[model samples]
Target: MIEILSPSRVDRARRTGALVGDILQTLRRRTEVGTNLLTLDRWTKELIEEAGATSCYVDYAPSFGRGPFGHHLCTGVNDAVLHGRPRDQVLADGDLLSLDLAVTLDGVAADAAISFVVGEARPAESVALVEVTERALAAGIAAAQPGARTGDISAAIGAVLTGAGYRVNTEFGGHGIGSTMHQDPHVANTGRPGRGYPLRPGLLLALEPWVMADTDQLVTDADGWTLRSATGCRTAHSEHTVAITEDGPEVLTLPRAA
Candidate 1:
C-alpha cells in the first residue's frame, strides 16, 4: 500500500524517523571488535523501550524470512548484507558491519541502515565497498524531489554503484514507508529514470542502495535471515527515510545532535 502522510502524519513520521536514526547512531558507536551480535540487539531493545517506541521488527514475519524475525536489529557482518539476523558471533577487528533498523513512534514508522568497519585494521576493499553504497544512497536521496519519479531515484542510486565497478542487486531494495514498515512504490537499486511511481508532497520513501563486492546474487542463511553474497564477497548497505516536500526531499532520519 502507498500510504500518503497528512500534515499530522508527517509530523509523527519525523518523530519516528528521528528515533530510528538516533538508535542506529547509538548502536554504531557502541559496536566494536569482540562485541557479540546479541549484545547489539539487546542495546537496541533498551533504547526502543527507553524512548517509549515500538520495534517494527519484533513480530515481523514476511514470506522470504522464517516466520517472526525474533530480533530488534539486523546485524550484518562482512559478507552478510540484508535482513541480517543477529547471532552469537563476535565481531573481529576490521569486520564490516551493517545495522538495519526500523521503529514506530506515535503510530508512524521510519527505517534506516548503516554499514561500517569495526576497528583500525581497516581493509581497503571493505572501506571502498561501504563508501560506494553510501554514495549511492546520497544520489538516490538527491533525486527524490516532489514530482520526481521513483525511477529517477533508482537511476541516481544505480549510477553510483555501477560506476564504482560493483554490480547492483534489485531483489530487495528501497520501499515506501509510513504508518507501517514496508509499503508500495518499490525503489530498486538500479532502474531507468523517468519511470515508476511519480513522487508527490507528503510521500515517504526509504531509499536504500546495497551492493556486493563482486556478484549480484544472494543466498539466505540457515538462520532464515542474513542475506549474503552468493560468491562470499563482502557487502555494504546504506539507507535513509525521506519525506517529499514541495521544495525537495527532506531527510527525516538525521540524529539529534547532527
Candidate 2:
C-alpha cells in the first residue's frame, strides 16, 4: 500500500529514523575482528527495546524468506548480500560486513543499511564496492522529490552502479515503507527514467542500492534466507529511508550526528 503519512506521523517517522540510524551506527562502530554476528543481533535487540521500539524483522514472515526471521538485524558478510540471517559467525580481519535494520516507534517505521570493512586491513576491491554502493544510494536519494517518478530514483542509482562497472539486480530492491516495513511502489535498483509511480509529498521511500562485484546472479544460502553472490564475489549494500516533502526530499534515516 502507498501511504501518505500525516504530519504528526512524519514527526514520529523522523524519531524512528533517528533511532534506526543511531543503532546501526553504534553497531557498525562496535563491529570488528572476532565480533560475532549474534552479538550484533543482541545489541540491536537491546537497543530497540531500550528505545521502546519494535523490530520489523524478528517476527517478519515474508514469502521469500523463512518464517519469523527471528533476528533483530541482517548481517551480510563478504559474499552475503541481502536477507542475511544472523548466525554463529565471527568476523575476520578485512571482512566486509553489511548491516540492515528497521524498526517502528510510535507506530511509524524506518529502515536503513550500511556496508563497511572490518579490522585494520581494507582490501581495495572491498573498499571500492562499498564506495560504489554508497554513491549509488546517494544518487537514488538525490532523485527523490515531489513529482519525481520512482523510475527516476532507480535510473539515477543504476547510472552510478553501471558506470562503476557493476551489474545490477532488480529482483530485490528498495520499496515504499511507512507504518509497516515494506509497502507498494517497488523501487528497482535500475530502470528507465520517467517511468513507474509518481512521487508525492508525505510519501516515505527506502532507496537502497546494492551491487555484487562480478555477477548479477544471486544464490540463497542453506538457511533459506541469506542471499549471496552466485559467484561468491564480495558485495556491498547501502540504503536510507527518505520522505518527500513540499520543499525537497528529506532523508529521515541519516545518522544522528549527520
TM-score of every model?
0.99, 0.99
lDDT of each: 0.93, 0.95
* Over 4 Å off, model 1: none
Q: Which lDDT tens digits does candidate 2 get at residues 1-258?
A: 899998889999999999999999899888889999999999999999999999999999999987789999999999999999999999999999999999999999999999999999989999999999999998998899789899999999999999999999999999999999999999999999999999998899999999999999999998889999999999999999999998889999987874
In model 2, what lDDT does residue 132 have? 97
> What lDDT is obtained when candidate 1 is compared to the true structure?
0.93
